[model samples]
Target chain A: MSTLAFLGEFGEAIQFIFEGETTREGTQVGGSQFLELTVEHIKVSVVAMVVACALAIPLGLWLGHIRRGSFLAISLSNVGRAVPSLALIAFFVAYLGVGFTNVTLALVLLAIPPILTNAYVGVTQVHRETVDAARGMGMTEARIALRVELPLALPLIFGGIKTSAVNVIATATIAPLAGVTTLGDAIINVSGYGDVGRLAAAISVAALAVMTELTLGAAQRAVTPRGIRLESGRPSRRRTLSTRIGRTASP
Target chain B: MVASAVAALTAPLAQVQLRDRSGGDAGCVADDGLCPGWIADNFDRYVDPLVQHVYLVLASVAIGFAISFALALVAHRHRWMIAPIVQVTGILYTLPSIAVFFLLLPLTGRGSLTAIVALVAYSLLIIFRNITTGLDNVPEEARDAGRGMGLTDRQLLWRVELPLALPEIMAGLRIATTTTVGLATLAFFAGAGGLGGQIFADINFKSNVVVAGGLAVLLAAVLDAAILLAQRAITPWTRARAA
Candidate 1:
């Protein structure tokens, strides 16, 4: 019955895609169908991203201010960046098994590094003069960082978050492989057939993903305070070597 | 320093020792006979595809850079093409790899060609934007000087703008290569080529010794090292500036 319907729908598949098509599995493919799937993907990804930001931003700021854990913090973030998300996904699947929770965990793991790295880099790279000036004015350490370093670091840190968000959103397409409903399903569903309809649907969803990525990116850009430029001076000599190591050791 | 030294020396080693002694529970790398040998043998299977993967990345980057350069040059001259071009590529970027794979699968089938085409598309935007940025960074005075000296536009671009743009171009290339290498893992899903094949094969079996996790790590390390070396080679300005 489903095959018959599929064949019936097949004639007008391209035209019918936006409207739903009923298949053998009793599943319907349409705009609402895609919308629901996309929403799910977005929700899972966003939640993970938010969690990552929550943990990463404060920790990143703190780590960035202190000189001691700079190496470790940087290195940890690098591992997050350096390791392939798929590899981590696979490792997560191995340990946690396949599910939304597992996939989300993998994504969160992937997401945290960039946010942490960027935030840390941004704060640490804050102009020493600016920091000194704040300190000279008798601002507390916390106040100095929150008022001075964080605002200056905002653009770069946000850039990292934006990059990570795009990455995770794109990666979330893989969620379907583990039996989660996502935009990834659009790709996997069309694997057996040579039909371009599924491919088109997949492409459409990916476009949506990219659109969301860009929208968030634009938001970050719009909010970026213009004063920050790449700090011209090299990091302290000790920091320079560690930064190199940190970059290589992780992402 | 002392506290960190103690933590560093003890923590990781203790964790490994604990996991090893515990035997079966560690998520990665199991204690089995001939794990290293199994990894070595599988790593051998990877050599050909790895070369192809490298070739694919280098070719895509070279081709993409050239294509983007031409586009950037035209767009720069025309001015109006910039927004539209960025918009189109931005759209292209959001399209997932799987979507690209399946979309091209009809025209190209499950071949390395499909991967190459997708990779080239992916590289396009990065290189294009970077090229334009680098070109834009060339000072107006420099362009005026070239004009006053009676240099042709082509000569000016080739001799002056390109040299100034070299570091930025190399940075874009570095990003392109790394992105391509990572994306190449998706090629394995198509069953055509790359180290992803070995990784997937082991993944399917859930066997650690056979899977060669260490080889994958090594492969990543080597690829990263290659990029670092390439970055230094291509951007002598960075090194000279550092000195």
Candidate 2:
């Protein structure tokens, strides 16, 4: 295709997406019609993240507090990385039947490992002296975990959440296959929307993923304690090395 | 309430399938509800797509590693380049794979080229970050010792820096390999065949879904193990030191 013609076609697709027009076959499409699909995408992602956080956070905190089951926690993170989201969705759809619930359940599974691993790592990495001091101060075990470890661990925990949220949003684009209409509907139903629709869908989904990442990344930074943030922000040799390891190792 | 909403949404699609099935072969009545016989009958069909899938992953990861390695080298030298490069790759990483597949379709057409392009783009962040980190973590004393021997920059990098960075580089490769394998499942959308195509083709079939989905999981596990073995082989000195 000529560059000019390609640019024209791209522009037209973007217009079609934002302006919302009927197809040549008199079918209503695009524009506000995509709002419903976007909402569906968010609904599935939110539910999955919520379920993942609920299950992973408390368990991860408890395990990290006890400093046990490091092997299980690490292995589960590895296995989670190995399993493809498409395979999980297909597995669920085959057994559970196609529906929103099935897709959400699969996404929940996808979101869990990162959250769990980060939560565990965060609490376990807290300084022993801090916890000891809390103990010496007559703090109970529960109080120590809550008042001491949890606060210290918040940054890594939030890092895990950010990763999970981004991953869940990206993976949710495939929910249409399970009969849950999301932004993927435009891409999947090629006969209805054509290549133009597919392009528009891709643009929207990419925008959504990037936006979600930016938003959550900011949230993560905001939640980090000021003193720790100052320490981490300054690029000391040890800090840089640990940060790099943490970034690659966790998600 | 959510359960009811799901059921309501699935009803029409189920009815449509039922109507279509009325005219098709009745394969659901098989024993044990698994239809292993169906798999046995059609086992040959999966071979071509599986090969295509593996080919797609290998080509993309190889190309991705080369590009990322070069970029990491440049960033390592300049230092200022790392942040911008990481940000660019992060954006690429965030782009949805299916969208990327279709977006490239207009330019590259529907084939393995488009699929490989998207897969390569997806891998840059992981591989590049790892390589840069590996290079940065090289001991200052080792670099000074190499310098004391009057080695040129090229020799220093090849002898002192890269050897020390091998573990982190291998870690990145392992991650990139497994991730690309997972993402390549969606390449079928671009007409580049894989196990995902097989699963999608017969999503409702127990035997087909099991075989194809199981294969994808198996492929990931096998690739991960292979990388681990390669890392061990290449980093034999580390093992010797530990022993």
Candidate 3:
């Protein structure tokens, strides 16, 4: 098919989401279906992210402050890569029975690694002397973490959030399989939505995923301190030789 | 459950029949518990999907590597191409594979080809970043010495830069390969017939899911290990240095 034909179909699909479409069985699949499912998708994704942040950020920041668990923090994402999301969901369904809570919990586990890893890296990347100076000024450990380290690590932590958000959103596309009617029903439930509805729903979820990524990206930029933003262009001598030697386009 | 167990235990070993995944023991299947005997009997069902899964991973990673290698080299030489290329591939990488699988279905049709295309798009950013980082990390002195010896840019890249970049390049390949393995489980959505199809076929079946899903994880581990081993063998210098 031509690109024009595809676009026309895509446009029609989008309109169908707003106006609703009826299946051959004469069921009224209304426009609200799209909004309803997308909202659920966001709801679950948001809940998962909030829980992941609550669990991972503090643990990661504490580990980094104490200078422990380096191996675990760094290797988590790598190990995460080997495990398939589908399997994780299926495993949950098989063992625990399927529901919103089960799927959400699985997603929470899936989303944790990137956030935890990034939080650890972000905090540990802070200068030791900076933390020392905070200590020397009579700040408590908790105060130093909140006042000195958290601000510096804000951009990277937000980066992890963006990543986890995108991942959780993507994984949520399959949440329908476990009995939650998210936007994925458009893709998975052909009988209910038909071909055009599937395409339309896919487009909507893709847009949502991209929008989340961009919004978080902007948040990351906003959180970055001006001094760090300016200094990011300059090579750091403090890093190990392996990291410092790279002569590439600036970050 | 007890009756089903008695039936399973009383059945003569030689008389075992190939029951459907859900056909094995009534209580066992009802409970969705792992029926090992049924799995061994039905193991053949997974072979084809597992092979399809392997093909999806290999073809996508190979194609992704070729494209990324060319782009990385171009970006290395021009310097200006890096940002745009990274941005574009990063978007491709960020888009969920399930979405990409369907998004391409209209344009590319529903088949392994569509699945491979989506999978390849994902590997581009990962492999490209690593390849470029590897290229860039080659010591300045090595390049200067090659230049002083009257070596041209092409010769220097092939003989020194690429070889030196092997470690990072291999790391990228390992990551891309493993990630593709995980993602290919979803290629069943594109009608690519992978282990994912098998798992999804009877998702609630404990035995079916365990075997099928376990195989996918095993495939990722095997490919990752193969790449790590290949990297070590090719870059004998790295091993020697460590020793």
TM-score (0 to 1) of chain B, per candidate? 0.75, 0.86, 0.90
What is the Cα-based TM-score of model 1? 0.73
Q: In model 2, what is the error at residue A74, expressed in angstroms? A: 1.5
The CAPRI quality class of candidate 1 comes to: incorrect
Question: How good is the docking of model 3, by CAPRI class?
Answer: acceptable
Candidate 1 ranges with C-alpha deviation above 4 Å: A1-18, A25-36, A66-82, A124-133, A189-197, A225-251, B1-34, B40-44, B75-84, B106-109, B136-153, B189-191, B201-224, B227-241
| Candidate 3 chain B worst ten-residue window by lDDT | B8-17
lDDT of 1 by residue, A142-195 (tens): 998788888877866787787778788877877765557776665545532224
| C-alpha lDDT of residue B101 in model 1 | 66
Could you arrange the candidates by lDDT from highest to lowest? 3, 2, 1
lDDT score, candidate 1: 0.65
**DockQ computed for model 1 against the true two-chain complex using alpha carbons:** 0.12
C-alpha RMSD over true interface residues, model 1: 13.4
lDDT of 3 by residue, B1-243 (tens): 334324422331212123355446778877778987778777898898899899999999999999999998888889878779988998998899999988886677667999999999999988888888788778999999999999999999999999999988888888889889988988888778789888777788899889999999999999998988898889999989999
What shift in Å separates residue B131 of candidate 2 from its native position after superposition? Answer: 1.1
Error of 1 at A107 (Å): 0.6
CA lDDT of each prediction against the hidden true structure: 0.65, 0.81, 0.83
Off by over 4 Å in 2: A237-251, B1-32
